[model samples]
Target: MVSTAPFEEQAFGRYRLLERLGEGGMAEVFRAKSFGVEGFEKIVAIKRILPRLARYRDFVAMFVREAKVLVRLSHANVVQVFDLGRVEGKGDEPPAYFMAMEYIAGLDLATMLTRCQQVGVRPPPGLATYVAAEVAKGLDHAHRRRGEGGQPMGLVHRDVSPQNILLSWEGEVKVTDFGIAKARDSFEVNSEDSRVKLLRGKYAYMSPEQARGRDVGQDTDLYSLGVVLYEILSGANPFRAPQPLETMRRVCQADAPPLERLVPGLDPGLVAVVRQAMAPLPSGRFVDAAAMHEALLPHLSARHGRFGPSDLADFLRRLSEQLATNRVPVSEKTPIAAPSHLTHDVDHDRTDVDLPDRDDEMAQASRLLVLGRDLLLQGDLPRAGDALGRVLVMAERHGASAQASQARMYLGYLDALAGLPGGEALLRDGLAEAAAQGHRAGARQGRFLLGRLLENIGLPRAALVEYEACRRLAITDDDPLLATECDEALARLA
Candidate 1:
């Protein structure tokens, strides 16, 4: 699929992008604040597929179907999906899609663990069990979610790691990032292609079957949760190794030291629970996520009397006060009530321009960068120059290096299309900047554009080098369409 072009609106369906939280191989996650009538402002996390991969109909359709199935999942322990939407392609541009989800104000388990490591304090044993118990409840809910017809959805959260376990400032645990989640019904759609059953996740958190690329079920989520529990209590991932292949081998063979042995004096009961949940065979593990939660509840009570969200909240509060640090990280601050001076204005930039918080501005800059590119594609050079130039200024002001690189790249392409000098140098510099920042997709795009330029200038060998590099990247990203394009380019050169 030859996917291209930009969004018509600056804000994606009226949810103003606040910050680019993170990006994965498949999608980019953004923190957005939605505005509605009568002072209604709601924070949501938006996960959108990368524009480069937007036209992969089979993959996008699979994600859309899973999103529809995910909307049915409503549990206190699971993060909610407020909306799922798609924008139709206009002319050469392929459709863009997104899913808006409940945003957690605090941090993930991984971040919390890092903070604890920096402060030299492992979480209390009871709290560890409590966190896992909460996650188990969420998993149970996801696994047993039913369709509108009352039949089982059989959802399996393929990626259940410490990073996916969100802890609110109020100490509530919510399972998040059902991005790679698979519904049982999804298998029948593309069962002919074995890649349909493939699961991608951190090797240390994967179940034996999952690590071996076999069929996964609800039990797979429980196994990953067990890894989380083990990490929390023992302060180490059981199968973690310096090398990826070694790590996979360890995970598949269950070749790790016993948790109790690794952390001396760890409650024997807790040890038993982790070991059983992480059993090599699916049958050896707990019957379901609910059973694991039940097993963990007693440990939570026995170790710390009546442990709950309040207790977790208190611990986080006290830790924040006690821990001394210099670097800014996600704050665990939770307000009891909205301030009296809060305004109903939807214009976030006006309120935050003077403040040190630049997420809103950065989001605005990102939007402009896209708009500039869209205008360039639409042959509106003057407007594209204005928008791209403004984005460069905003990117520099906020120190958003990646955005700055992209802005320069588009501006260079714009200049070339309009018969200007120094375009090639700017494109090369932008590609170099992107490479330094590890933006593989952006760098590959720059290479592809550079290849076109070189080919136009009667330099087939140089163009071949650039297209070859892009082919490798396409293969690495698992973008078959792009790989095929690169193959066609190479064939022409040959």
Candidate 2:
């Protein structure tokens, strides 16, 4: 066991250390809690500077300067620094500098890759584009950050390594640890080619200019980012070597391995972007991160059609119903057993139930419901929900049952798929109103749908109540298949 002795609290006042999260050669990080504010608990990664390096004035100045640079650029995808201070301690205590940054509750890309190796999993197709887009946003924020003089700070993250990129639990890709970064005018040019020879970041991700000790610019970071992307999509680095010298040589002289050949079926457009970004010559790459995003936009989007999570969820739900219930039957002449499982229910259980209606209500409700279902089939849930949700707005605009309870059921289903905690309750409320109207088919269908909603949201036991109710309603309404389905669902739940 890595002893917790190094991580014990009381080393730093106010910031109570909880557990050690990570350690680099120069710094030790901890999961910490702050005593400064009420209910202000956070995972703060503390990088305590090495005592040996403390004596070196240049390294200490550089370290603190980097922290200041990071504090100024605050974007959603960039890690935030709450505070930066010197850890005051006695003679042997080591005059350490610490940076308290927003604790990212996820692994760095390097660690994520190790997990992928452990689980034997490859990243999904669109995931690379999505991740690249987010990272580009972070890069864009950092690259374009300006000063009070209204001049570009000319900041470029020279070290864009997997270790510095964090993936949050919420699927957010964040760029962090801007240590060793260079300001356009601030960086001291040691030699004619000192820019390339300094060796600030990991060699595996270095650009050709960086490797060859040549003058580097923003395109260097772009090249490094391309290498990271290549490594992420394919399991191997674009340039690898058995020795340090060999690695540098490969970075200078080698061509990036053809990604398409390695990761077959990979998006050719994405491969092209990576190829252009990783070009040996800086001028060959995209002018900026935004340009790269635009280039890969087509490949990053969803196949069949592109839609947001809400829209996609609605589409999948409606598609499921249509195919499963024979509402829009597929021909047996088709070779496939069923629709290929290529599509996913990204936000499967989010429902957006609208208000009740009266004037031209049924027609309005029908149109909205049709629009919602069409949007759902096309994988556009937000617009679908917006269209469907307007049914209630129409109802409120006019007065009740403009949708004839069926609209409520469809809207309720949408609400559940939306992943709202209160969505099931809303569905049940709709079911109660539906039952009160004595619409047996609606009641039966509502109960059946309620069971499905419950099941989807991890309320399997509660779903049984709906399933059983659906079974009884089916029997009362002479729906044999529905009753059978209810019985089967109950059995599955059991």
Candidate 3:
């Protein structure tokens, strides 16, 4: 469990840190309360560069430069950047860079997808279209932004995955994470080196040009948005593969299966819209984000009768209610004292804790599992591995077999990421355990991850078997995302 001591006492500028919401490789986010005179207080999200990364001049410059552009953006569909500055660290420590932005009190698209899987329902097609269209509107704004001299800024959001698309409880769709965005006036000192050193966005959502390391413009963002739309409407990414290299290959070749093949009754016109947005060549795609947004509007309005934020808000409210009752409740019993060995610090002076009994240990294990997953998504592999390892140990010791299997599944993915051996064994064991326990979701995830690992290891035939198995499981379990993923993988292998 994360200790609240450090965060409770920390203050970045006028924002008093309340809790560590989540973290990624480059930065950590905190839910903070900003103070002002006359009892004025507002909750905000404070994103700060990781301490170790602060010393990297290139990354620091990019962070500041991105903040400059973000601060100038104001749109209902975009998260507003309120303040950007450096906070002095304690003692002789170097100052930390931070940006306070509008805090969104809702789930990201990824989390919402998971929630949908849990509840056995997907968002309505109209609602999905609306969300994607809203994102396109935001991208259009950034794409057409002007500089101090009213010159075109030519901003391109390099990263436009589900994680960066937030859906508020009030049904607001907001696009965030401009940290990797490319703009005409960017302050990046070494653009070529930066591009070569790191791939900016998620591989599954990257455009063909981006996957090929070529120059990207507004069209690239539209392509990424198309992927998001496809996932939302059909419950899967069309170009996704079991491995990054394979996924990139499929992307470069534009090898996604037709939408109707996955979502059998999907509207042909809607499919055409997505196809145009995700066209293999930039020249074949929509001219800009605005054109794409306009194309989606008529379809959205026709199918869902004046669909808007209120309609989405109502849908989300219902989903939340369903999830509230369906989700496993975390143990509310007081946390036991931590064992000496488990008391080591993890980050921001926050120490880990070990509970005394099985119930408490299981609770702690669950929390650690979520923490590890978040870290993994953020590309902090080392810390993610450590957290998942702890979960495995704790779950095993407490006789939480199902939880242990979950931990093993993630550990297997980490192994694949590191190109280490034994990932197959871990996934196989986890899959068996999940199956025995009737955990369909866990079982499907295990198969999916295993397929990825197998493909990455040059075992294409074996990967096909796993993907086929997952496809069957997805169909039986009514999981569109898993089914779509399997379809994409099968298409690549074919």
In order, candidate lDDTs are 0.73, 0.65, 0.76
For model 2, residues 1-494, the per-residue Cα lDDT tens digits are 33556655655766877788766645667778776466766657766665655655676777788787778989987888878888766866667778888888766778765443322224444555666677788888878889878898777777787888887655677888764544212334356755533324577788888877677787788888888888777755756643566568668864555777556667777888889989889989989877876776776566545423333233334333333443211111011111123353333232221222243344434444544544543445565565556556554445556253555666667766876566667666777877787767667877887787778769999999989989998898887757866886888888
- In model 2, what is the error at residue 409, expressed in angstroms? 62
Model 3 segments more than 4 A misplaced: 1-9, 179-200, 302-304, 327-494
Please provide, for model 3 over 1-494, each residue's C-alpha lDDT reduced to its tens digit, 9 standing for 90 to 100.
33355555476677799889887746788888999999999999998887866766777777888898899999988999999989887886767998999999988999887666444344666777899999999998988999999999878888898999999999899999864545212323345556433323578898999888788888889989998998887655666644577678778887776666556566788999999988999999999889999999877764215567877776676666655654432222122111112233322122222234676456556655755654654567776776677778777777777778888898878886787888767778888989999888778878887887788678999999999999999999988766976998889888
TM-score of 3: 0.65
**Stretches of candidate 1 exceeding 4 Å from the true structure:** 1-10, 88-93, 179-199, 302-304, 322-494
Q: Best candidate, lDDT-wise?
A: 3
Query: Which lDDT tens digits does candidate 1 get at residues 38-79?
Result: 989998999887776676677778878878877878899999
Top model number, TM-score: 3
**What's the distance in Å from true for residue 110, model 3?**
1.1
Clashes of 3: 0
The collision pairs in model 3 are none
Question: What lDDT would candidate 2 get against the real structure?
Answer: 0.65
Cα RMSD to the true fold for all candidates: 16.7, 21.0, 12.9
